[model samples]
Target chain A: MNKYIKLMSFLLLIIVTLTGFGLYKAQASSPYPELKVVTTDGKPEYIEPFHFLGFVSDTQNYSNSSTIVFKDGHSRYMEDQTFLERIDFNYNPQLNDFITDHRSFMRGKSRRTEHYTETEQHVIYTGMESDVYWNQPSRGLMTIAVLNKETEEEETFSVSLGSDGSYYEVSATYVNYPNLTILAATNHSTDISEQFVYTFDVENPTEELTETINLTQEIDSNGGVYFGQSFDRTERFIPIQSVRQTDDSEFDYTEEIIGYFAFDTQMQELIDVPLFEEDTLLFADNDKLYVGKDLGDTIELHEMNADDQNLDLVGSIEMATPTIGREEGTHYNNLFNQNITLLDGRLYAYETQYSDDISRPLFQITDIKTQETLFNGTIEPKDMAKHDSTNIDVFEFRLDTLNN
Target chain B: MKKSLHNFLKFTNFELERLSKFLFALMGITFIANLVGYIYTPMKYMGKINEYIAQNSATSEQAIQQYGPFSFYNALNSFWIVGPIALGISGFIFYSFFIWYREWFGKNTFAYRLLMLPIHRMTLFYSKLVVVFIGIFTLISTQMISLFIGYPIVSAIIENTYYVNQSLMEAVQLHPLFLYLFPLDLGFFLTINAVGLVVLLVLFTAILMERSYAVKGIVLGIIYAVVALTLVLLPLFLPDLLNNHYILYGSELIIIEAILLVIVAVLSLFTSRHLINKKITV
Candidate 1:
């Protein structure tokens, strides 16, 4: 039995060894890894304009088949990542789309107005204005429309540009003022306050650069002053044909501002003022004084009385930054910090309240000098269609008409 | 014999680096794997030897049967353990080749032939056996030391004695014995491993003796192995063929295994003896 056992034991070892050898020959285990491509910013911005969350398909086919998403109530678009020629669409279908089957969705029926700022560049959809819509309406679909900046002949629609250069249709059609003048404001949208968009009659161009805040002013002794907005924008701001040339051009395009003025009424005067932190991004002349305070909530107006450091707690109200597009315009107020601005003897305050979809009221136009409301209404946020997640210049709008 | 043993000691005394190398490799690889495994895929990484206990940690008897620390040690000490491992199967192959070509037995080549040796045939056998056994000794002792150092090595990283204790205790629970001793159980395992070489040696002896054709000797050895396999199968496979409902418990299976090992050791030694003493003719 022992001999038999010995013999058998020998055989089993051979089997195990052969198996081990086979395994060794076969090779050990491993888990090879791979990589993915992603783009960081893709919302409406100033330089190159399109609707919010809007990118034309690929620039290769900018006129046809490319669509934009504007933020409106009860709407969202989800498509697998695909190649697009001009991917952005307008908030108002009437502007970009015609009655359904009558027009092949491929060749959308609207007159093609906005061509790509750069030919053959792929247009991506970025969701810039969607969040603003979500902030306002809280829930429910809001309509946001997009129009080629060049097609905007007059007060065409309620609009707000995205981080990407695209105009998103907002549900607001603020009582369309022929000319707007934003003197001062606080407590408003995250984007720059565009109280005015002055047109330069000569230059014809298109671009997208979203976030912008432009103003020029002077102050007096008691923090009382009148300042007019220069309906100015960069990227979309056209320099006069002569001004668009070079830095040394005859027409000075140093910092494009068509019209600006500060009335000498409620003026605060000081010999000289403390310079702000060079690093500190000054949103406006008033913003330099409004530091460390929660500006996201409300835009505060204060008195720069002599040495009264705390900007002499001059009465502060809300200010609203207005958006425009194809829809009529309006405004909204915030629940927390309000955008407070003093314009033309009136305090235009806006308190933005956010929801799943945003639809804010325009500034509460109250006269600070007389304490009366000149205009108070909700402003239009971009419809869901104008939203994009990738394109950064959503606010880049073009001018079809110039002012006298 | 004492001189032989001394020489053997001297031979292995310098082997610490090699042993340490194997142990280091074993341990380093294990530690890294354990570390990565603990971080990435803990379930696949750790304490696998203690699986029986892991699945039934709540159970008492089954837990005690595991050899957890040894498995864990084997993993971490692979760097050091690899050297000793080279002396195992590869060593056997090398030694077999040496013995085959050298005809250190019947009639090949070697300075210390049984005829030329100034000692009895058995003395030479005992000497070689001692050397081989010493190799086995170093292998097992290194394993034990590695198993011991595993805690300290792991502690360097974790700095948690309680966790170490828990892990070590679980490792211990997996296997009841602290050490697997030689010349009996362990010795049996090695001898069983050497049986194929023994059968070859026997044929080699038959070649020198010309008692049968050298090729016939190989054929006979193969036939013997097949016959033996049939006998072993009678109890395992034939029982099923007979349809008898016999069952074995844990201890009984272990005892049977032990017997089998002992049988291989005796048979291999017996064959070695015959090969050593066989008369050389051609």
Candidate 2:
């Protein structure tokens, strides 16, 4: 019986570990998976569940810097840097959240945040994190798993950053089962003349290579620059986030995640209007897109469509930015972050920013074209939380969505 | 009757003093930690408040005008957890010490057999319980005294702890004795909890004295402990007693504790009386 008990204990340990590892292979993880669990919306082409569902395949290798030994006695992994890694066992058993740094070097002082909300059902695991070297950004990546944990499934898609100092962010997700995983910002840059990059599958080895073109256009000057995800020409110029360098002169570059309330790349693109406070997105009676922005006082709404030819001339609704100031420095600075939303068939816009007393996400909806107030209301910033993305500061302010 | 009463008084005093000695030594550590908290908490709160003002660029005039006095209410609440932690550890340590005492007191050695001389064994039981109660009293008092010295000074460091406005000082002053008194009351119930505990201790002691082997003592101790727990649990788990307690509030824990005590005492009397009467070559 003693021997049997020992054997059963050993088997339980093995099964639990194997179950975790098997799940790991299916969830495409980032360098910091604790950070990655926050994404719920799928990005364009990156799709939902960026794990195993793509066409091409490739493998990269890296060395283990720490002499840490695994319980399995296996000391290495399939050296892909972009694969998101969980902090070495610092994750908690009950909460399934990162609790500490597992690496011996990071003992005592933890550099990672532990608690995160999974807005959608996408899986990501951390692979590793390294200190910034020379002028390079901190090295990390998502280990894209091609299978789903629930379905025992297999997928064909696998891709990686083509250049150094470039990274992908999985930003949003949908709540439904077999949830979609989205990817934002690939390492590849775009040239206007050349539209796509082509590559062939590794196993199947198709005769022809695949093509990818990241098409983006800059629209206005709000100091908050953005990139548009939609291919629809009329809605091409919305803003999401303003990128600021960590250090002006250093050789290193790392993406600092901040909050983005007004950063929507396609929010103002279709309407040719600045997304003022209290602008709303509407589907219209004909199912054409419409948006509103509070210009000065009376709000304006613009009739919008995805058609490229007549995109600019779509008439707009008009509104105003409320001229209210603080009565005793007690009020918050309600400025900067903007939201242009199209819920159902109506368009709305809102503004929320930061102050000492109050710093959170809140916005309004207005007319699409004229920056006019169709109506004004505040939606909790967390409510309008972007799909599948953790750092709303980078892509959240820019990505466009039809509110579900 | 008078002789038995006299013997009980002597037995209870001796045992209670020994328990106090152990508990008093433990409180020496509690007092030091509490003193450290009193000095350290104010300094830490001031540091956080200073950082907040400096980073946000605020002045003293602005702070007083904007909020109120410098009172670290949140920081004050942080140190309050120490009292409970100290009390809990002390309680466990005290219980373990008593278990050891029970074992040592039962052997056919100089101490155990001496106490059994011309004594109603009930006197010995009351002595052990009084000792436990004394130890609990000393430990609880040390914890409360420490927190009383710390909370006010820490609260004063925040802009407005509002505790002062809410009559916190007066409340603390009027009820300082209750701080030690409440836990001491729980300690009484806790000491009473040891009735079955004493039986297991005595049973382990008896078996160990007879058997010269190490396994007998440990194995017997474990078995006795388990049996004691089950017996003590009977009244709590009995369908009728449970119904009275849970549904009707018609029964009291003392009644349950008394029944268990009586059974253990009866068994202990018979075994000890037989063991004393039987001739054993020491």
Q: Please provide TM-scores, in order, for all candidate models, with all chains considered together.
A: 0.26, 0.34
**Candidate 1 deviant stretches above 4 angstroms:** A1-404, B1-89, B96-108, B159-164, B167-169, B172-214, B228-233, B247-272, B280-282
RMSD of every prediction: 29.3, 21.3
The whole-model lDDT of each prediction reads 0.31, 0.36
CAPRI tier for the interface of model 2: incorrect
TM-score of chain B of 2: 0.57
Per-prediction TM-score, chain B alone:
0.49, 0.57
DockQ in order: 0.01, 0.01
Question: Which regions of candidate 2 are displaced past 4 Å?
Answer: A1-169, A172-248, A251-305, A312-338, A348-350, A353-362, A367-404, B1-68, B72-282
Candidate No. with top TM-score: 2
- When summed lDDT is taken over every stretch of 10 residues in candidate 1 chain B, the lowest stretch is B176-185
* Per-residue C-alpha lDDT of model 1 across residues B157-200, encoded as one tens digit per residue: 33231122224422422232321222222333343445543444
lDDT winner: 2
- In terms of docking quality, model 1 is incorrect
Deviation of model 1 at A124, angstroms: 83
